[model samples]
Structures are given as structure tokens and as C-alpha cells.
Target: MRTTALLFSLSISFGSLAQLQPIAADVYRWKDLKIEKEQTRERRQVLEGSARDLDLLEIHTSALEPGKSPHPPHTHDDVEELVIVKEGNLRVTIKGQSKILGPGSVALAIPGEEHGFENGGNTRVTYYIIKYRSKLPMNIDRGKQAGGSFMIDRSELTVKTTDKGSRINYFERPTSMAQRFEMHVTTLNAGMNSHPPHTHRAEEIVLLISGSGKIQIGEQHKDASVGDLIFLGSEVLHAFTNTGQEPCSYFAFQWN
Candidate 1:
């Protein structure tokens, strides 16, 4: 009877752990997503899994009609969220300050920061949300010292022109859940490769904003269109090439 009780307890403990496996390095197409229509908006779940440094990594897209908000401003004590505008205009409020941002804009809300979003334009507004929690303990003070939560427009950033294309730096700072977080936009001319396959210690995400391309991850090559996303795990060799006739642009964000 004692042995049976011990076995039952062990089974329950193991079952309580997350059954979701770690996400692989691959491209997630936008068209492949299934939309779930809400009362005032539409939602599409992209990916939800674990990463090397994060206990949870989840991504989703939301589209809100004119003057609609998903919910009221709230605070997340354990999760950090990143919002990237894909289309239309978004009014993002972080800690009481609200700003209307157009496509390619980004908002970073650290843990415990009150944040909310809504469609600020007459048309529909679409954006991607990246929610994550670190494997380490949450440090709200560290994030606050690093600048707390904020939003930035893409046009406000400086663009570095190159022979192949241009690169725009977004930000690089520490968050409550990560020691280092960096984001940038890279545009590649037709038939141009962003770079030779490269590996980094931080896990990275490539979110295509314009044109089309192909991403090479390990031994696999996958096609990516506008609104598609590619996630590369730590130490994974990956590269992106503009396969279309026109130039392609993508946002690359990494953290550990």
C-alpha cells in the first residue's frame, strides 16, 4: 500500500509539469494560422512553447476594428509582453502614457507595468504580441532601472544604409526576465542574403514586415511571406535571403 501511494504521488507531480515541448527553429506562416473571431477583434495564435532561457514563450496576433480594445489596462506580475504593429494604427498605453503608432512600431511592457492597446485608426489595426517568462526569478527593479516599459515608433529610429540594403536599430536593453534584449530591422535587396548562416547565444525571432523571403534553419529551408515569423533557438545557425524581386524587410529580436 505504501509503494502504491508513493507511485501515485510521483505520477501526479510529473503530470503537473508542462507537457508542451520546446519550439524548433522554423518559419511560422501567417496564412497557416486559424483565426478565432472575438466580439470586437480577431485573434490568431502563432506559437506557444519553451525556449532555452525562458520557461514560456508564446506569440499571437490580434486585429481590432476601429475604436476597439481587447481589454482594460492590466498588469502582469510574471510575464513580459512585446507588441509589434503589423498594419493600421495602434494606441498603446504603458503606465498611463498613450501613444498612437503606425506599422512597424513596437511596445515593450515589463512585468508589473500597466499596459493596454486599442485601434487608434479608422481602419483595422493588427499587431503581434510576444509573451514570455524567464527561467530565472522575476526582477521588477532591474527592469525599472533599465527604463521600465516604453513604446517607440519605427520612424524615430536611425537607419544605416548599406550596399545591400539598410538596417534600423530599435533597442537593446535589459528587461525583468532577460539579461539582454535587442531588436533591429534588416532590409535585404533582391537575391541578397542577410548574412551567412550565423549562431548566437540568445534565441532570436524574425518577423517579416514587407516582401517575401526564404529562411534557412539548420538543414531546412522555409519560405516566408509578409506577416510570417521565424524563431531560431540558441546556437542554431540561421540566415534569411530575399527571394522575391523586391526588397524584403524583417524585424529581428533576440534575448537570453
Candidate 2:
């Protein structure tokens, strides 16, 4: 009887451990630029599953064709949406105003607001989308039935580039629980470097989107190519330099 009881207890413990195992990461690639015209784009990458799923969901290096856009103006009562333009141009309509978002531009749409997007340039528009989730389940379709409209005029967004070649654009500040920061890096024609060695309160993850560069974190530095990802811990001094013939472009996000 003693032996049987011991085996049963061990089995229960093992079952509980299995349930606590983490979820795997899932990556979705973009095959085309036009599929659903009314909502969603053709060229877009989506990351889902346990690894990508956190308090926030981020879409990186997303490319949208000229005629395609995401879902109609909709509000999430429990989540905040952030958009950052990396390349090309886009028209973003929020409430009743339209703004143009060019490379290095960032915008934030609070929860319960109406928003939409449309590509304005001839080339594909690439941008990053970050959605912050609440502890409770988000009602994405909220306010659709009332007189409140979910669609925003595509002509309301204005486009402008920052003078600081490549600089950090933050949508959400770092908090004790979960924080997100994003930035765009544009190398100069003759190649330049970012300095003054700075550290912050959150960890950082970088994604190289265009051109080539080298990232120096603490005493370690390495060459980075397109699609390369680098992770740095909090309070780690880091900087980057443009090392390629053409201008190098990249995006980074810091999470706390």
C-alpha cells in the first residue's frame, strides 16, 4: 500500500509540472500584399503563441501594399494600440483628424478610440504595431452597435520625418510590470555612430530591418544583418554604428 501511494503522489506532481511548461513561439510569414481588401493587408508578418504572447503583442517589419489596410476603425476596451512607421508613408485617421506617418514617426491610439490606416505611397508601407492587453479579456468589437463609428478618414494623418537621422520613438513608457519602447535607426550617407553610452531601466530587443550595422553592448559588439535580433539586459550600455555602404535602418523595443 505504501509503495502504491508513493507512486500516485509522484504522478500527480509530474502532471502539475507538465502543466506549468511554457508555450512555444509561432511565426507567420507574409506571402502576398492583397488578400482581404476591406480589412487586413496582404504583406504582413504575425507572431502568435506563448512566446510572443505577453501583456503586449508586437508586429515587426510589417509591409502593407498601397490598397490594403487592417480591420475597420475599431476600439478595444481593454487594450491600447501603438503604430510606428519604419519605411514608406501611411495615412492614419483617428477620431476626426488625419495625420501622415513617415519613417521614424510614432502614434498612439488609446483604448475605446476609433482608428484606421491606409498606405499613401506607391511602395509598400512598413510599420510596427504594438497592442497592450489587459488582464481581462478584451472586447474588440465594443461600441460597434451605438451611433459611434469605428472607421476613420484616411486623409487625416500627416507625414513628417524627424531631423535626428535615427532616433528612439517611444509609445508607451516603461512601467514596473510591463513597458515597451521602440526606435528607428538610420545610418548616414558616410556612416555615423550613436554615442554617449546610455542605459535605461528596461531590457532591450533589436531587429535589423534595412542595411547593415554593428551593435555594441557593454564590452561586446557584433555585426548585424537584416532580420538579425539582439537582446540586451537592463542597465547594459549599448550603441550602434552604420557600417554599410547604404544607410542602415533598424527598430528596437525595450520591455520591462
Q: What Cα-based lDDT does every candidate model obtain?
A: 0.93, 0.56
* Backbone N/Cα/C clashes per model: 0, 10
Per-residue C-alpha lDDT of model 2 across residues 1-256, encoded as one tens digit per residue: 9999999999998676445422221112233223333235643444421222244443434567886676566766655666767678877888867776777566666567778888878888877676655333543343232223222222343323444353443333432223333343443332777555678765555666677777787777777776555555557788878788886666666543
Clashes of 1: 0
Checking candidate 2 for backbone clashes, the offending pairs are 33-42, 73-150, 98-156, 98-157, 99-156, 99-157, 99-158, 100-157, 100-158, 100-159
Error of 1 at 159 (Å): 1.5
Candidate 2 Cα errors over 4 Å, as ranges = 1-40, 43-54, 133-200, 205-210, 216-222, 226-239, 245-256
Give the candidate number with the greatest TM-score: 1
TM-score per candidate:
0.93, 0.54
Q: CA lDDT of 190 in candidate 2? A: 29
Worst 10 residues of 2 by lDDT: 21-30
Cα lDDT of candidate 2 equals 0.56
